[model samples]
Target: MDELLIRLRNPHERERAFSDMVKKYQQSVYYFVRRMVVDHDDANDVAQNVFIKAWKGLDGFRGDAQLSTWLYRIAHNESVSFIQREQRIAGISLDRIAHELPSTLRADKHYSGDEIQMKLQTAIALLPEKQKAVFIMKYYDDKTYDEMSAITGTSVGALKASYHHAVKKIEQFLRGEE
Candidate 1:
């Protein structure tokens, strides 16, 4: 990533650098977006938009954070914007999305999970958005609270609390108590 950033700054090498960066980060970005969106096609679209936005705004990148963090931030915002836009256009709420996620995941060609995995997805879907993001980043992505705080602009204390709440809720959901 450091090498890519160096190449990114050089006028002549920027294209190759961007290409390499995309190659390096695409799967992580896709999965990150996918976890939020559920539908594979929507995830693909939002992930692409994240990369495009990153490419267009690369010149303005201030290097205050790591490239992965910047990209994750973009992915995060784009995913949220997508859900908000969907809500506006389709009159669907987050609860509706969560309610619909299981069937959608089951229908998705990319999803090969069994019933338990589907239920876990449903549980995750039921989380409030911030908690969901925190859970996904910390548990699935194995990110530290500090890194999450930087990417999400949330306090570490809040993120930890959110994660704890999310875990408890997911456990409740999984145990069929919720």
Candidate 2:
């Protein structure tokens, strides 16, 4: 258990500790959500929700995992839940949303990626949600399989497989094969 975790668990010190934690983690959390959700505003809302959940759930956090791993798990859940809820409310299928992302990316002023980067993001957006998360965690975040498993509640073997499939799909998409 780290000092921050200890402080977070301590009711007396929790508020200050959580503030510190947020400052340390907010950008990473926001970017993580941003990669998944695409839109800046949507990612910001989801990131806030992630922190809100973290604040409410901090006391129940056991010291079995690192605080970052725990936070990533929360972030993964919140991002996936946000995507699912948006899909339902918009009455759009995952495939539809995925297809729509390229145009959306083109119009997003906040997205400053180059042409190649935009193409890469479009390929990533075409992935299934779990595979997309796996790809982002490994490629962008560089999380180890153990860390990814802790964050995603997935077996290491499955994570490896998912990463492999996501890579293949991205390759195919980039090559204009599918």
Candidate 3:
């Protein structure tokens, strides 16, 4: 890890470090952003921004948290900011997307594996922002609750509650209970 940090600290080794970081975390960041935005293009854009922000901020990183945790916090902030800006410009609430999902899911059978995935995505999209953040960091990023708490600055109990609430909401959504 120290060797990697040394490589990361060198300007000439920046490309390799950046590439390694991207390779290591890109998918997690992409999916986390995608869960928030529900748009592939927007997710891609936000994921790129997350990496860019990380690269710029790398020198100042004090290693207080795992590098992955730090990157996730960046991704979370970028995703929320993107969603807020999009909501203001489009006059559309992310909530409406959740409410409309059953119809959308039923309409498209061509994408077989994706039907359930679409429902799942819709359910995730419905989560309150903080709950969604915790859920994504915990589940999608495979982060420990402790890491999630640090990244979100929420207590472990709160993070656990948020994840539980998110799961219940998703289960209800999937079952057509809500």
Candidate no. 1 TM-score: 0.95
How good is model 3 by TM-score?
0.85
**lDDT by residue for model 1 (27-123), tens:** 9999999988888899999999999999999989987789999999999999888877887899877677778877887778899999888988999
- TM, every model: 0.95, 0.95, 0.85
CA deviation > 4 Å runs, candidate 1: none
Query: Can you give the lDDT of residue 70 in candidate 1?
Result: 96
Clashes of each: 0, 0, 0
**Weakest lDDT window of 10 consecutive positions for candidate 1:** 92-101
Predicted candidate 3 versus true structure: per-residue lDDT over 12-96, tens digit per residue: 9988988998998888888788777766677889999999999889989887777888888898888888877877898878778
What are the RMSD figures for all models against the true structure? 1.3, 1.2, 2.7
Residue-level lDDT of model 2, residues 1-178, one tens digit each, is 7889999887889899999999999988998999999999999999999999999887688879998888899999999898888888999976777677778888899998877788788888778788889899999999999999999999999999999999998888788898
State in Å the error of residue 76, model 1.
Answer: 0.6
Q: What's the distance in Å from true for residue 162, model 2?
A: 0.5
**Candidate 2: TM-score?**
0.95
